[model samples]
Target: MRNGNRRGKPVEKARHFWPTTKRLISYLRPWKWGVLLSILMAIVSVALNIVSPKILGQATTDIYDGILKGVQQMKLGLHITKYPIDFNHVGQICLIVVALYILSGLFSFGQQVLMTWISQKVVYNLRQDFKEKMGRLPIKYYDQHSNGDLMSRMVNDMDNISGTLQ
Candidate 1:
């Protein structure tokens, strides 16, 4: 059957999602601080990106005002001379925009790095637990199961999980 949910679990399997979600949450609980900080950084980055257009508009407004001021002075019979470019203010705005974008990029990169670390830490814990569980299982259990199938399931499933998280 075609999948309904994005995760591809059928209605029957949907019943398992909550418990699985709870288990995953338990695994992630240890890295709550990293998760929180990453979210904060993401929010700040988005906010900066959103504000950039308005700041750019303000820059054009400032240039327009400068031009109008220069024209008025020319009409008043002063030297028909200097272009009214405020290099200092324009330079400051350019620096501010550049800094904001740079900071946003830094924060986004930091968040990705932190998230990767957290996911790896969680995967490490899960693998350790799986190893311990395997050690505790009886030889009879191993005899009942295909060793190659078990190994493939564990390794492939874990890899899929790690890929999804990262």
Candidate 2:
């Protein structure tokens, strides 16, 4: 007699998603240093983003003050050293701003690199371990769960956990 199942391949049984999640969480246990590095990088990048604008604004205010004072000093034939408007001083201030911008950009890039490395590593390890576990799992485990359900638990659920880390 021919196989007469309506679904053709076979219907998958229900899987335990929670156990898979717990297993994946365990994979992250050994990567505390990478995780911490990622966090630190992110924090520094955010702080630089907040601080850069303030520094630039200060530079602008200082230049304006220098210019106003320079004008007053020039009218009295006094040395411009005491004045705020000196071109050299403005140049120095501009240099500082440029330095700050470069530093902030570097920090932001570092955060991205560290986070990507840490996240990818953690995700890779979790997937590998999960795959191994699935292989070793008994046929009876599959008896209660559908293939689609298991796949979703491995892919979608793992992604959800990684997203939480981010």
Q: Candidate 1: what lDDT?
A: 0.83
Cα displacement (Å) at residue 158, model 1: 2.5
lDDT of each: 0.83, 0.74
State the lDDT at 102 in candidate 1: 88
Estimate the Cα RMSD of every predicted model relative to the unseen true structure: 4.2, 9.9
| lDDT of candidate model 2 versus the reference | 0.74
Report the poorest 10 consecutive residues by lDDT, candidate 2: 1-10
Residue-wise lDDT of candidate 1 within 1-166, one digit each (tens)? 4755567766445457789779977998998988899889889888888887677677777899888999999889888567687878877788888888888898888878888888898888989988999999999999999989988988886787677776
lDDT of 2 at 100: 70
lDDT tens per residue, model 2, 1-166? 1443565755555488689668656776687777677678677767777876777777678778877878878887887656555567667767877777777778778867766666677888878878999999999989999988889877986687667665
Pairs that collide in candidate 2 are 12-146, 13-145, 13-146, 14-145, 66-84, 66-85, 67-85
Q: Which stretches of candidate 1 lie over 4 Å from their true place?
A: 1-15, 64-83
| C-alpha TM-score for every candidate | 0.73, 0.64
Highest lDDT against the true fold, candidate: 1
